[model samples]
Target: MRRWTPFVLLMPFQFIFGLIYSWGTISPAIHVQSGWPQATLDLAFSLTPLGLLPAVILAGRALHRLAPKTLLAWALTCFTVGGGIGLLTASPVAFMLGYSLLALGVGAGLSTAACIALVSRLYPQRRGSLGGALLALYGMSSVISAPLFDEINRLIGWRPSLAALLAVYAAVGWLAWAFLPEAPAAPGRQTAPLPLMVLLRQRPLRWALVIVLMATPLGSASFATIGHLTKAIGVSSALGVLAVSLMALGNGVGRLGFGLLADWISPRFSRAAALGLNALAALLLLGVLHGYGVWAFVAYPLLIGLAFGGMAGKLPALAAHVAEHHGEAAFGLLFGAFAFASFLGPFLSAGLGMHSALQGLALCALAAMGLGLAVAR
Candidate 1:
């Protein structure tokens, strides 16, 4: 394979996100149009992560044995079908199922299995930077998706916008599968399949896992909080929408910026600082939640956005390190476990509610900080 082949493969990956997850930015608008309460939309959004749990674990195992490109292509097809189903129908159950399908495809194909394979095999020297750039690209989807979807929904409604996304996911997946080369399997350098429990037993490994788990609530709190701030702070819906784009910008910046830091500094240091910043950001939210207009409107998203965004690039690098320290075979399982935590964070944060979630997430951040310190030491 040419050296630049993997980089080219990233295009479809970015496009899938632009269509699928980016659609999330317009979720608020969808809520209004469907006559469904925010809770219903939350329920639908929640399905993605929830559905990811088994999907990620299973995908990891399958990729260990099968060709990743083939699997990715099939998963992308599933994503298209799932997304298509949800877009065409307004049934709450159907919508949730569609999201679950998309989640399954993404979890199995994009987020865990294919991503790990791509970075670990192709860009060994530039792990942090490459991973961060990839994640940052994913974050950019929100910026592109939010206003684009908002405009699309205005013109044709949510259903058509979703259907358009479904088409994109399908096309991108097919192109990637057709062209992306499979890395040749190695001999002798074998990994033993360790159970999740055994992998979690190592202290450093546990801390690394905890970092992702801890990050989940932090990221989720931010996602749910957008609407809350609009209501509580009395910001114009326009400003609230703008905040979402800013958050996406912060997310991309964090991924690329912190990722570069991870390469220059130690992953341990980069992760610890990120978690501490997360704690501080959550604290900032708590302090400013009651403040008027600008502070209430601007402060939380800016900080939370940075903290959550920074984690994407760093976490995978951290995971790879932890896996290297543990064993290579353990990488898939450990990452799967981490994905489980990622899935849990949003719902847990949502359950924490507007005001209280910040405090709970702050504690999680502090705990992550502690774990990070232990890992560093």
Candidate 2:
């Protein structure tokens, strides 16, 4: 039980923060209830990653100055307050602000950088597998939350259901706070931190940046507008929500599965394979756009979700591998850089129509695969 404390305590927080991925479900409801344009609702989703970038940097720095538990407490408070605001107000601006506030809390408290840093300290040798497991739960959050929220919306209404969801998140956050351990202290003779400019100049980090930029856009587009895309393709709205849930399921499985593969084989092989998966997903999306048939409705989401999860699971391990001597601080910086690049997808998707967005995603995936293969060599 003591050995498992980190996993037990942290998993819940990851799940709660993971709810951010369920924006596909939430955005559609907002569109239906408020009659907001799809693009405008997508802007709300895009704001999350934009907001997260700065908060992650702040949290990474604060980890040295404050207790992890304290940061997490603040995260919970922000998320709950944001949700409460969303519940009380119907204004789109207020909703975007509320979600942005939630993004800040997630970045500052329950972020991947913070979690990976802590877990790496605890299980340095198994960081790849452990990071995969942690993020697998993160990907799965949408799988569980989206349909649950959709049902709640059906039974009551979107606003009330949101309040209930936030209430549960608050309870879970408190539980995680009570149980999560303080991060272990650093070694007495620590190496000096690398300058950001120097770190960015390294070969592997550059490749990691390219990979993140290429892979994230498709997943971002799907996550932001899967429900709308499904409906546009003639699927029922409920089924559209279900497709998002299934996509999330695939995302979780891919994370867990691909993370284990990285541990078993090599990070390079695992990443290349994941990029291949992304390329395949992109090709399928092209077929879907051409009216490939009903199978695409099921297939595209699962494949893209898998590719997305694979990228998320593998990238940290890749960073750790490339910067083994620099330690977790360096890993945090690398991950932060990757996170900044990842925001492009949702922002791009927000402006483009669905068909054009899919075309762009295919091009992005193909380009990523070509670059990834070259980098692997």
> Clashes in model 2: which pairs?
none
For candidate 1, give the lDDT.
0.64
lDDT of 2 by residue, 1-377 (tens): 79878867878778777777777688788788768898687677667666666566566555555555666777777777777675677787887787554643354334666677667667776777888898888767776788899999998877788778878877887777787788775432244456567866778776777677777778767866787788778877778878776777778888887877778888888888889989988888887778877576677788888888888787557766665555444555545554555576656665677778768878889899999888884
The per-prediction CA RMSD against the true structure, in angstroms, equals 3.3, 3.5
Q: How many residue pairs clash in each candidate at the backbone level?
A: 0, 0
Report how far residue 376 has shifted in candidate 1, in Å. Answer: 1.9
Q: Which stretches of candidate 1 lie over 4 Å from their true place?
A: 18-20, 23-29, 32-34, 88-90, 103-111, 186-192, 230-242, 289-299, 325-352
> In terms of TM-score, how similar is model 2 to the real structure?
0.84
- How displaced is residue 299 in candidate 1, in Å? 4.6
lDDT of 1 by residue, 106-158 (tens): 53434445665566567766767776787777667655656666777788887
> Pairing residues by index, what is the TM-score of model 1?
0.85
Query: CA lDDT, every prediction?
Result: 0.64, 0.72
